[model samples]
Target: MSVAARIAGPDLHETSVAPRSRSRMLALVIALAFAAVGGQLVRLAWQNEDASTIRVSMMSSPANTLARPDIVDRNGRLLATDVQMPSLYADPLLIQDADEAAERLVRLFPQIDVRELRQSLADKSRRFVWVRRGLSPAMAQRVHNLGIPGLLFVDEIRRTYPAGRLGGHILGRVDIDNRGTGGIERYIDEIGASEAAVGARLSARAPVRLSLDLGVMHALDEELAGAMVRYEAAGAAGLVMDVLTGEVVASVSRPGVDPAVYEDALDPSRIDRIAAGTYELGSIMKLVTVAMALEMGRSLDSMVDTAEPLKAGRFTIEDLHPLGRPMSVSEVFIHSSNVGAGQLALSAGAATQKAFLQKLGLWSALKTEVSSGPAPQKPQQIGRIEQITLSFGHGLATTPLQFAAASAALMNGGTRVTPTFMALDGEAPVVRGERVVSARTSALLREVMRRNVTDPAGTGRRADVPGFEVGGKTGTAEMAAKGGYRKKSVLASFIGTFPSSEPRYVTLILLFEPKGQDVTGGEITAGRNAAPTTARIIERIAPLLGVPAKSL
Candidate 1:
């Protein structure tokens, strides 16, 4: 201080103020100016900072998109669930070198077009752009390591199927925003399950429980898949249902689709055959015809002549192995005689046949939680030919699901049963529908069905599980084509009920276009393939269904 005062002249220091006071004031003014200049520089730096290094949250981006709830089987087994995943996005305004960023990203994702991405990133008007969606954790980490500017990640919920393709047609699929699009997934949305939930967080509601038993479903799936390979069949479909409650415990269609793969569901060849398509069910329709005969005061032992082939215009209806004698009604069912069934239909008249079919619910479409199947294709009028063919499962096409529902009613003691996919909650009583037949008629039908499995010459003899007492009908019909029926191609199917004395469950197995095999005695009949397949399925699923194997 003394040196500074000496250097400054004494006259200058003493003129207006003390040297120490003036020096302090000057230092304070300088400090204030520097502080203002430092703040401006810091502000400019922040505005120009590299956005790639910064993390931007898109929490409120898809605010209206609500997460879906878990879909579980009857035993609380997981089928479908929501999982948190990081989806990639970009802020175009923050992208400094758009060309460089796009080029780097294209290397990681070969599917992305670099030029299109470049244009998207170069547009400063849009603050956000989608880079990629539904990225796996490993995939997200790989993209993060690239260190591209403007690229960011947002947490979102995506639907995941745990069992892969199992129950795909039943569980359905979701959209990009996690909204239900088809199957039971869409049913959830229709019931307002996601109405109140409008965020990325998953639905807090208790999981949706289906009537399907995972163990039984797996058994059915495996058996059907094996059947397809064993029989050299083009496709296969099967279902197991609780006859009393009308609950479809298991439904599977081969060449099964995966819910995660949207394209698979859209494929026509991969459609759910159980409930999605209608087919001329061949001999299975005789179940309805025989039920009509029983309901019309005809005894099981009543004889109907099948000595001559049925002639209708240009068509001649006959049995594959005609007995060439007057056959009893019970024999008519056991043999699956087309001429016999046609006679029963003619005796009852065409009007009676149509009414019985309509009463059985086979004359219309059957809508389940899975799908509203195409309406049954039937003749416009019930002429002699139409009535004869309809009686023996031709000139009329209905879904296997609809036919199953009708059969369940017959097996469940005369009461109508509407097939359902939803589980009956709690100790809810099994509400029975209107009686479609007399209890006496139901008992007679049961007696004959039992004979069909036990009798040596029965068409369904191959379908008998040792202790399950399976009774069913076999069908092998030439597949219909543009002009007429395809001679060699057939839809082989068997529909049976277990513990036939008092039926509990109904099983329907279908094998489409099965080829002749040595094990089948070089025959492509339902008894050779579909019947034995049904037997195998019954043996496997009966234990899971709580239907204990009875002592032979």
Candidate 2:
């Protein structure tokens, strides 16, 4: 063989073999890498898309939206909260064995009616069915252990009022879908939900802070509850407010609902008597009349004849407990004389009386949107009959909140600050309010009211607090129904303030349909029921409000 030919042939063959070997190695590595990547993608998709991975939420109902944000007392104690709950539901379509699922569920949750559950699940026409709402974690765990495929577990938010029935009327309750229906809940739902509806669920703000103090609320609730027991009263309601700031520090309405379960709260009467109910608050009118007369240039020394009844049309106005003689403006308040208050209203004239009340925010419903009470009548077209009757808190029905706000105005330098449910800022915001009386007149009225409650001989002696310098007026009005005045039923109310010289807080307590008893001296009047309750509340709440005992 020729040497050149042999060298060329060998070199060419070696180069071809090396090219083929390198191509095979590259292809093998590329294939292995592609397989690893594909496996990772599949594993990720399976992990994220598992059947149990889906989370669902039920729609919120309008009625349920009224459920208020959490309500916290001033000290940050939880008065109310929204508890996380697990609910049992069924996809009838998925439930192949309805009878088995229902039986198993009922066996686990004894509270559930097995027969009813079976019937409900058997109704296949209904795609979605609720087994129950508000299940506990333990209950949820048991239900999960059943492991029945078609039965589903859904998470729900239910309102939990830890205070139980305490402050129920004030905090209110929500509907099943977690919307606020009444009380603070209703107020917050109306104002608190827009931002929460976004996807930022974790960013959802906390429940609202109320002007209420939980400690104060607890004390008031206890005192009123005791009164209900002691007086054998049909029901009782009480409230306290910062006169200068319009903050409700404590409120109680007996027969309140348990937010945890409102459906079973059968007695509809447990609704807020202070905000939704109306009353012909009687001598409580004296507070208005006194403020009216003083603003019209009448002095505390101004005298009115109260020895006998005042004849008006067919009506004769007399003090419940007659003074038996002329009464000074101060004496009129102390005696709680209807004759004297009527005279003041008449002398002030309808226009002036109406104007005074309108300024005091009494001519209209109280400005609180949380209210459901009837609006106060505006002097029935502003005339004499209406004015005279309104003077004694008759012929006009106002919610207790209206009476409280007006009384606060009378004591807070005559400036009517619309009552507020929102928490006050660290320092209260200064709002220019309507002036109902001159500063001097308001001062004089405060003095008169003080003497009425604190004076030993005053009609409201029961309302007196030894060192707190209690000042208030009593009202015992006959309850008027469509037929006529309820012969035996009365609305007993006491409206007043404390440290009368420099007023800080205003409070009121009311009793509805209190039965006459020996303990009440057969009077069944506000002086007997509402007055004493108000006194008890002040005695307990004074320290909370930072009200010092009067200096000796």
The top-ranked prediction according to lDDT is 1
Assess every candidate by TM-score: 0.88, 0.82
**Model 1: colliding residue pairs:** none
Estimate the overall C-alpha local distance difference test score of candidate 1.
0.89
In model 1, which range of ten residues has the least summed lDDT?
50-59
lDDT of 2 at 277: 74
Task: Write down the lDDT of every candidate, Cα atoms only.
Answer: 0.89, 0.77
How well is each residue in 426-495 modelled by candidate 1, as lDDT tens digits? 4988899999988878888888888888899998899988888888998898899999999789999999
Tens-digit lDDT track for model 2 on 1-552? 234544566576566675566678789899999999999999888877553433323233212232235578776878877666777889888888988898888787788888888988888788778898878999888888888877877665666777777777677666776666766777776765423431112215675777778888888888888877766778888888888878887777887777767673456776678887777788788888888888788899988877778777777766667858888988888877778888888888987877777777677776564555568654448565666678888887878887898888889898877777666786756674777678998899888887887688887889888899988888888888897898688888888799789888988888877776687897787788788888888988898878999766
Worst 10 residues of 2 by lDDT: 194-203
Clashes of 1: 0
Query: Which parts of model 1 are misplaced by more than 4 Å?
Result: 1-59, 196-199
Model 2 residue 391 CA deviation (Å) reads 1.7
